[model samples]
Target: MTAHLSRRTLLGIAGAGAGAYLLSACGSDEPSTPDGPQTINWWHIQNTEPMLPVWAAIAKEYETAHPNVKVVIQPLENEAFKAKLTTATQAGSPPDLFQSWGGGVLKQQVDAGLVKDITADVQPWIGSLLPASVQPFTIDGKIYGVPFDVGMVGFWYNKDLFVKAGVTATPTTWAELLTTVSTIKGKGIVPMALAGKEKWPGHFYWAYLAMRIGGLGALQQAAKDNNFDTPDFIAAGQRLKELVDLQPFQKGFLGAEYGSPDGQAATMGNGGAALELMGQWAPSVQASSSTSKKGLGDKLGYFAFPAVDGGKGTVAEAFGGGNGFVVGKDAPASTTDFLKVLLDAANQRKSAATGAVLPTVKDAADAIKDPNSKVVAASLASATGFQLFLDQAYPPAVGQQVNDSVAELIAGSKTPEQIVKDITKVAKSQ
Candidate 1:
């Protein structure tokens, strides 16, 4: 079905923020013959190896199978694509299919009438995907996107350092985690590595803390109410303060970049720090950023963010995001069908085997060959609730305020109460 979005929708998205949606991969459905020759304009951020050729080959085959369709694919780098998409959306024209990371951005697109409500188109095969992975794209009970890849953020620790500190187990509670950090520090080892200068990574701690203490529903409620100044949110800041007060990071953490020579990943990779809070890409980035170009080897281990003493959330609730594609409101009917081809279970398996994705298709989990990827895939498979990153989940202004306020909180410049107030002000304005 064709949809029209007015120019006012562009202002709504810009003044508000951005959005993205995902797709599920599974059912074997062939493209329906179109009424006439149609061109599908597609854009994605997988502008690199392995996936680049994989997508090209898939498109070529799809074209060979359906001569009436011409798939014009434009693979752009991450930032470049974001800029282009912004320009396209502002012009009331988005690529027929493009990358998305389902959150407030996707919601705005839907509200602005820029994205398709593909619930009916995908319903038959959607069940093949993991439920939690689809949580981000389900707005007002309608599916706008489908998730092909999903993952979560957690504590990636150095096992040898844990053993060196005489710690026998991973921390299961907030208190236990604090004790672990202190214990690790007592041995003169850095407890954690963080990119303090980069606000996004630091926000993960606050988001996870909010999730653990206030529950995923609390976040959703806060977003809807335009209020983040709740007791639970305040308590979340207090809890984060408890950990920050311990001064667990490396010496120059406040100025460190995420992937630089002396950055968070490199520190973790070189065994200079005991732990880091990162997403599924931690291992590869660590290795690539390390001096030796090989990270901790078998010494690396991962665990979900620890639970709190009397929290409403559980370790089962995840916090992270991954790649997905959204169909433009004006996209051809075949776009969704072509999306089906892209996300078919077999294709998902191939993507999974590439070690770059945690395919959201549940039945495709066995295709994950890397042990670490398998771990994350399994977690997504059983995830009870999933929250996208706060920066992406909220309107850009609100999300950036979260990152800013949390960074201030961590930097000792903002109090728990003040950060909540700051975030609430921005949320209300949004």
Candidate 2:
């Protein structure tokens, strides 16, 4: 199903004023000159097929166009890159350009004067990209980064499994979803595929539940108040607990990874489970990780997260974030220009065609050939509200607490109330 977001609601949930303090603290050192020769150091997490070569090709083309400019590419896995970037940024020396998800973490880097404010530099070509994609990178009224990909989370289900389980249609309400889960379980099929060991994938369930129960505003308010001890949040955990009690995930799911052969993606792709709550990239990961390396292909389907019975938030609201690149404080003046090349309409379309990225450039949307991708893109375009991933939206400590507590709740080690209390304590500390 498609969701629509009003302009006002979009701006509010985007957290426009949350990073105001970043501006004052982010003072750049000497700017790199555009003259003579310069090398741009870029670090990104798309270290696998399609994107890995695509990015490398783009950089090579840029170097050929401008021999004086050399682009150094250092591609790393997601978690490793995050750890390395943290250590580097803490030392006040980051890559000239690097991967950025654009939320509290980006704000922290801005506050530490480790990133550049590229508002005016990107203004000329920024209009070509979707506003929602740019919103994440925009701090206060200034843009600090450029988005190359944008998407939202939803259910990627195996249609054949659902059919075998006697589920005629996708679940639209919380009750229907639970019933569907039970039905699937009754048929001796795993109802869901989750990466419990990774924590982030598990957090998606609780986050979407909270959004449905308390509305998008509830999360923003909770962050502002530094408190998650509200009825909505508590109810979110209770609802998730209800599902967890069903024991619908794959065997040993708690130890499952996200993209490994025995992980969430492979489980879903190989039809070991009926569905997965994941982002637009789910299909590609599934295909790459599956034993056949072909996944379920046309048998896969997509649907928005189910709504709650009397929830304040509509199914129209979305929860997800995109990938982007932020300029390091000392990046050459041409760095923004190079970024523009990466996001140009043709390149964006190429990325979309690979079926690995949901392009951020408005005109490139039509290039999305994958049916599942089209569904997600349509949902994102029509979303009534948008929430960045919880792990990126709030302070690191608070976000980690949310993940940790949710994992505990799933493991049956913590009650709903206890999870809320644990998260609240960390939020307050932040």
Candidate 3:
């Protein structure tokens, strides 16, 4: 989706409250549980196979246990759900429970008084989750959301392809990465599979480059100061440009979708590309999108993003985010209770078993059967610094600018200096 559309949607919700529409059928003004049965309106983005059935089964179990509670579910595609939720929140009534990425968007909801403060309600079991998993949901030392899945972004490569390219070890630094790309290209294999049409995937390169060059504090400082025109950010664009100059991506990559048959994940899963920089869900997406409907089984391997020599960031620092659920301010008290059941170790294990999510519950880690997922989980656990996806870390306008500018840079239409200036302009305006 374009930045204009996203910003407009968020703006609508930001201005909502006084003259917004209310859900008359749901009795908006009544106490959460007054006279009769209580219904929980839930909206989630797991509308596809594996997760769809898993979540539905869980909801059924919850309803069976609580005869007085009625759980209403509305499964939506990611962008569709976001747009609908934006309208609902603007109408002054959000779902009782909804998917949350736990970043600036959640912060906006919190500031608007749309989300509930779940700190107290989850205090007892919150400690059972990984600290890193909960970090994003904590604002001003108070929690507003609960994470069920947590992970980081890294290179998912085909071991056989690496061998074909004569690459003996995974690159650990920027210089080595370039060399690896060149070697892979020499072998006549596409060095990388990128979903350029989906701007977020391309932004991963610039974002990770910035993290490697300026460190995690640089991102926070830029957001705090509303400026991104720093030397470090400029250098990030320059380094990313260096990679683009090599023309390492698959042919017609600029129009590629993320999970489409000919897109990034499928290209990698089909062994048509050497690697792809993606999150923990990469393997699952690859498998689902490929012709065989089964990605390279044991041949797929994982590695952390390479460090940039002389840069402030270490290989230990990670860039990524995960999925969570937030409660609406007017949600019934039973909402928290149901959330507790959803995130219980056993249920989390069930979710993890799908080989789709990296569980947040500490004890549920053992349920991760996929080797690649285990690698990602281990990296996240040991990460010294964490950064959420840029698009999720900033307001819609600023975040979208980052994506747009990076896409321009990759297309050879914008200079590093121009890209940072453009991003800074949007940041300041926001």
Candidate 4:
């Protein structure tokens, strides 16, 4: 979903573009402080516990501190939020502050004149947050969103299932991973759980394979050249095809929903599958969706996506994105001011304490108490490189194309060469 420059340099690059915007009338680029009571409409996706109440409490506290500003909260489910936001932005209006992953979507909004440039407004404390986490929000040297959480995707496996299958070690290489899947399936165990109904989940396999084989810059270069017809990308598709041909996923996986009772998370949590390639949120989702509602607990393990034998990218390069908030074009000035209060270290700690987020505020790290989350935090801390999810990294149309093409590959309805050709056509048009 993203790329960025050196630490603290992202904002500093807002020289000419931001300067031009400042000189132009535009639409209140430097919004004035509120002169009277104002309502800030906020739309988020933390509709459930650990975060839902936390957000409410934060808004309440902010209102108490600044009676002149009223925060109107609207929490929607993830997919629902995306659809609604799409409709609103297309209609020429969005919530004052809304949920944003801050890559291609944010870029699209910016290009469409739907969001604000808050670089100057956030200058004072933006440096206190993790630079990498902020990277996705910075497009063309200007900051459009503020990240509250950051994470990466990896293999979340059932350690107990691995033991039962006699796979004593986690696979560190692609070849070994294939062997591990085969051994697990041979034991009559489902080797993997995938939400095939959701094209995004299936795309992870193809994206990671590309990252490993083509290296970190491979995808970026493709976007720059408006082409995916490359040997490395073709190899990525071919590798994913090899895995698909193994028939390692749970039955009905092709139609399974991600958070449904019989979905990918439930399958993994119930020990129906040995592993699932998912984001950092996997454990909690598994627990909530599973019959026990307690997940696998200590039996769950996280490992980096395995390396292809002759790959250029290392296991240390991470692939994921996290939540952030972006200001709408018509938002009142108090919106940015309230964001300062909302993202302060103390408030961020409240979020981290819930184990629902990998806090972007550096000082809030100690609040993470969940064991699985702790491992994920440590992994992100040590990552040598980072890339936002492929779907978010590219333009909206190109990103969707990537997901659709990859899903076709998994369905055995498309070849690697065809995947490249399809994506190239879309990317070139964009």
Predicted structure with the largest TM-score when compared to the true one: 1
Residue clash pairs of candidate 1:
18-105, 19-105, 19-106, 20-106, 22-145, 22-146, 22-147, 23-146, 23-147
TM-score of 3: 0.89
Clashing pairs in 4: 1-388, 1-389, 1-393
Better candidate number, 1 or 2, judged by TM-score: 1
In order, what lDDT does every prediction score? 0.81, 0.82, 0.82, 0.81
Per-residue lDDT tens digits of candidate 1, residues 108-160? 88888899988878877788888777877877777787767777888999999
**Residue 83 shift from truth in candidate 4, angstroms:** 4.7
Q: Give one digit per residue, the lDDT tens place, for model 4 in 57-84.
A: 9999888988898899998866677689
How many Å off is the CA of 371 in candidate 1?
A: 1.2
Candidate 3 local Cα displacement, residue 383, angstroms = 1.8
- Where does model 4 exceed 4 Å of error? 1-37, 77-80
The better candidate by TM-score, 2 or 3, is 3
* lDDT tens readout by residue for model 3, 1-430: 3422221121111100110011112212222434357899999877776688899999999889888888999998767888899999998898999988777787789899999987767776777787777777776667788888887879999999999889999999999999999999998999999988878888989999999999987887887888889999999999999899999999999999887789888999899999999877788778877889999989999999999998999999878777789999999888988899999999999999886678889899999998888888888878777787888788778888889999999999999999999999888886
Error of 4 at 76 (Å): 3.5
